[model samples]
Target: MRTALAAGTAWLLATGLTAAGAAPAQAAPLQAAPAADAAPLLDAGSADGRRFRATGRLVGGGGTTCSATVVHAGGRPDPAAKALVLSNGHCADDTMGTNDVVTDKAAPEGWTFTPAFFHDNVAEQKTFTMERVLYATMKDIDVSLLRLNATYGDLAKLDVTPKTLADRRPAPGTALRAVHAPSDGIEDGRRHLRQSRCTATAAVPALHEHTWLWKDATRTDCLGISGGSSGGAVTTAGDTGRLVGMLNTIATPGYLGCGLGRPCEGSAEGLVVPKDDTAYVTPVDAVASCLTGSGFDLRRTGCRLDRGTQVTVTPDGRQTRSTTPDGPARWDVRITPGQGTRPTWVAVKSGPFGAVDCTRPEGYGTPRRLPAAGLEHTAVLPAQDNLHVLCVAGGPDATLQGAAWAASLAHPAYAYVRVDNTPPTVAPRIDAQHFGEGDDATYWVRPVYAPWELTGYQVKYGPRAGTDCADPAGYRPYLNIPASLKASQGPWTYCAIGSDNAGNTTAPAAFTVPSG
Candidate 1:
């Protein structure tokens, strides 16, 4: 999960910050620092809290919070320039698609950051508005480089310092510490910076979490990490610690399989789910080469990050395309090439539903090469059953083969097609209720039972029985009828058809009024 620290009434009550009927105060704007008297104080015993004055609580446009840090490429930077803040890409925009890459975009309104966000000195914190998103992407990495409206000189006046980005990835077993402003477990309900002592466990070649697949991630045993910890600074342990990575996610407990909160490590052998309490960090070394004196420039010499346009694989017609066993089990999809993208290779792989790894080439057959630049190209998946995933990857050399082809592929576009001939076996049941009497009598019918795989149901009602129950065009969506419908519509006959995730539907089950 991206760890969107939620702020709600329940959290206020749990923290005893608000009384039963008292209204919470509205958050102040980030134009200036809050009054010292108006801020909450923290424990004075801990001295380590003062070290991470650059780390702060980042509030998204949607009101959710995450951790972020002020960072500079290296040595001395111009203090007059607008400061740069680093955080997870999802923090900048959680709605980013699998291959979405956002660059040089205007920051959403209401986005702010509070530096010097220590539990001990909450009163000293200053909020600043985000001016722009220099670069933000979740492709092969989860990172965002944001520019603040305030200048480094402005922050320096308040004794706020920026952490230096480490030039390389930290080796396994390196002593490390994580500093973050997490919202969970805070008795006061305030987002306060917390620190954890840990060590780098291992390097994950690829970490698969839901639709995002991150490469070269560092796994750690960091404790005290929770909601609002996304983009927390993971640095080498010391007084002058340098930033090595940023906390991205944790292995959430209770998830039985790999997905979302439960990020699985992928390798040639397959995926491995880590035990609960495990956390992962994305290395920041790649960002170093991209940073310039002004800000980030993707065209920089040594920057290996993908700056090419995104490839799109869209189905010809309906977004959801399905086929039955007896029907032609093939789909026609259009591969649209983005401007500036290189020649692309398209391939299709199929497996049991939800088993295919769209990022890997282990099970993929051969790939068909597409021209360097084209408006669109059509690719057909070889006839197969189960689920098919069509992937399109771009690279430098169009004729690259074998390992070179797999290695050169970057930020591939994917589309899915599901094939299943089995229709839902179970029938649907309806519950009917009557209210009032005689002329004022009203009847309401609701579906009470549906198959486990049911996605939705089509229902039709009239004075007579329905004909051609399988015709979905004749029915409306299955919704609870209002009690206002007159029961005098008497002897009404209702028919229901259910559709499953595989696009297969069950035969209509009918119920007659008064007789049902």
Candidate 2:
């Protein structure tokens, strides 16, 4: 349940203005810091010449982490197939299923890293251990991809697919911008942000080389890059935007360890890699050449190394798309032809406080309500049917009480049928059915894009067994979907219910409990 928006952390990738006389830029905008101001990253910028800068939080209060530009060896972002792109595997590993303990023994070729929480924040900077496998799978070839997790706060949203990373690498020396939630007092408790030049490419393609990598600032006011600042990006300056590598570890590693709810260290250490840090880019090309027994031109997809499938979306007249393994979280959308000048298209799931994750079950991003009480939002099938609407009643035939429902263990159940115009675009017709797909399942909730006045969802289910197939009582209803029946057992009765924002009356959308 990651978000589509990484908020301001990774937002720096947005294209910028480089006109000859571009107006003077203001410092990064930041929130009021906790009274201890400037005490955290107290003396980071002392050393000069370092690149990269950023600030970010862990998902669901994961923890604070920072990001910086790769100046020395990784000065700017590079889309060059030559460099490797590294990260903690779990950054986008939700497809492996939740709570899945991480292990590197199963590391494969294409798996990118995860939210750098455990890796950067662990007690003693753990090397790949049996008990402490890196999250997600790892693709070593690139020297800078390894990472440790850290905790700061929750993340906005992110796009983590092979396709997403494929062409995102910028040409070497591109104007790279970085930011992250600084754990130190670098920028008065606020994020320490910075813009810098990506220097050059790494000499080795091995992922382990990352262990020997270190930072030496040759410039000033560079304190923006501080602790927990791993897994960020280094890009180039231009009309076209790209992603070179993420802000790996930051500034310096501290033995003091322990951050957020985990054991961590190196309050300052930035780490990352070339965009294409995989198991084998060149040799694999030869392998592909040998596999086909012919010179294989596999880079056609534009990625130095193909990672996974790509997912596309036509958002608000834009053709931006996402390509991830677990079926595109579909976020991380960028405008082509013209970069940063346009807005990043997103499904706008939930508002500010309601993000899509376990801890913030409140919803995605922020919380939105039906203008009135007792209404449920939903979407229709087929992308063309975007008439997202709200329900003020139960079954289409149910009374007009405007009963709504917020029934779930995570959220409180409320039932107020006041009829309002605020609700989720009726759950996007449950596509990828991660759960069972039986008749009892609600195939799709249908996103109710625009708001409308209503009572609740029109859920119908049930057909009693052993009763006359044609009898009215045999036709019970449920909010749940129907299941395929065994032999021709008389007409199955189902339940019909209505849901609104406050709560929905559960009368139908149900099936008979199978007997032993």
Candidate 3:
């Protein structure tokens, strides 16, 4: 997760790819609950305060993630060749085996990811520049870079000139801005936190105490920045259009969207920061590392390197089918290299899904959706040395069909779920919610299960009780949750929407609630 840093102009935050942070209170040493019975390990709105960023996957089982832009040490600008890719170094545990091919011409899902993008590829991509792991001592500074040998692709195409360390140290209190990359599942950019100052420091890992320059706690928002979004940039736009550092990371959620569960709120929520006990990266030269060599002069032309880009290649799927979501669906297997990540949505909706080229604005085209046959299934595509492997589906059950998928941004080819169900994750259950006299309210739920049962959940609300639980009709059920409770006209009479994964669904269990 990204955190406070020495960079100015309200630095941005990064996803996970580093050390661990203050461990949350032990899960009360949980005991096994019924097969599918459980509650939310956390509330729908409390996860944001943990001082971490979303890794775009189910972390600790499930969470939300965002992205930032990152550049190499030395490089020139040319969109055709190189630029920064807002992704993670070792995604989902960096399991990229040689069997997982990073097609120089054909990528897994019709995209080309080079050695520069791999975690081990660090040796190759980092050649032109120096590499130094940021210690937890430098919390909010978990950033790294790859000095490029050439420039092309997005950076050159967009002529995006990044701001240097000096340009960013804003006049204290100057409105610092937060930035985000919607490439992963995020669709908007309103995710800016605040330009903060490193107030004090102690013997902590990669973090530094900061005098956060925020308007108020109510205005702060955060997501767990996990795997895929490794070395990204978190800066603000200067009148000149250059960017600077805000925060970087070492790790994010273990899985994509952390099960797409609603983010946590309240005390569990904390500002994002660098991994634990790591060193700080406040040296101006180090900050300059993200740019070009000092003598190279950035004002003229930007870095001279193309770090990473999406390459298209046909997939190895042999089967094709047709059908629809609401009714019967249809699908054709041209599994060849198609453009875009996050293809799940577009493909699931129609045939193809939305992908990202980051080099441009149009984003990407929709490709075929996954889960070819089964539901709630996950695949493990390792790209360590370009290794590939195939697994067998054990059985066909509801959980199997409607479950989670584990993928790696570095690998992009493999995704699977926890086949073994010994440590079952508990589904979330809403015991009861208390609405006080005025505006505050509290709801109780379960926690994460052993076999990754229920990571957390989704909440909805409305004036009517029996409205669509999965997709609430009105704003009643969600009136109490963080993002949804923005428009509460009265007090704590917030209704319950829906909860899943981490605990048993309340909509299925609770027969009724007081309708507001």
Per lDDT, the best of the predicted structures is 1
TM-score, structure 1 vs. true: 0.65
Number of backbone collisions per candidate: 0, 199, 194
User: What is the descending TM-score order?
Assistant: 1, 3, 2
TM-scores vs. true structure, each candidate? 0.65, 0.23, 0.27
Q: Identify the superior model by TM-score, candidate 2 or candidate 3.
A: 3
lDDT tens string, model 2, 1-516? 011012223211111111111111111222112233222322223221122112123321132232321111222323232212233232333122111223233323332222222212323211111111222322221112222232111111121111012123333333434333344333443443323333333222211111111111111111234333333443433321234345432212111111111111111121122121111110111111111111122233322321211112112211111222344222222212111112111111321111112212333222332221222233211121111111111111112112211111111111101111223222211111222445443322211111111123343324364433223353332223334443234244333333322232323333332321
Model 1: colliding residue pairs: none
Evaluate model 1: give its lDDT.
0.64
Distance from true location, Cα of 494 in model 1, Å = 22
Instruction: Give the range where candidate 3 is weakest over 10 consecutive residues by summed lDDT.
Output: 210-219
Mark the 10 consecutive residues where model 1 has the least summed lDDT. Answer: 25-34
Model 2's TM-score against the true structure? 0.23
* Predicted candidate 1 versus true structure: per-residue lDDT over 353-396, tens digit per residue: 23545556566656566554443433444343333445566444
Ranking by lDDT: 1, 3, 2
Which lDDT tens digits does candidate 3 get at residues 106-171?
A: 112211123212222123322121122121111112322222333434333233333334333333
Please list the residue runs of candidate 1 whose C-alpha ends up more than 4 Å from where it truly belongs after superposition.
1-47, 238-240, 268-270, 315-333, 340-391, 395-516
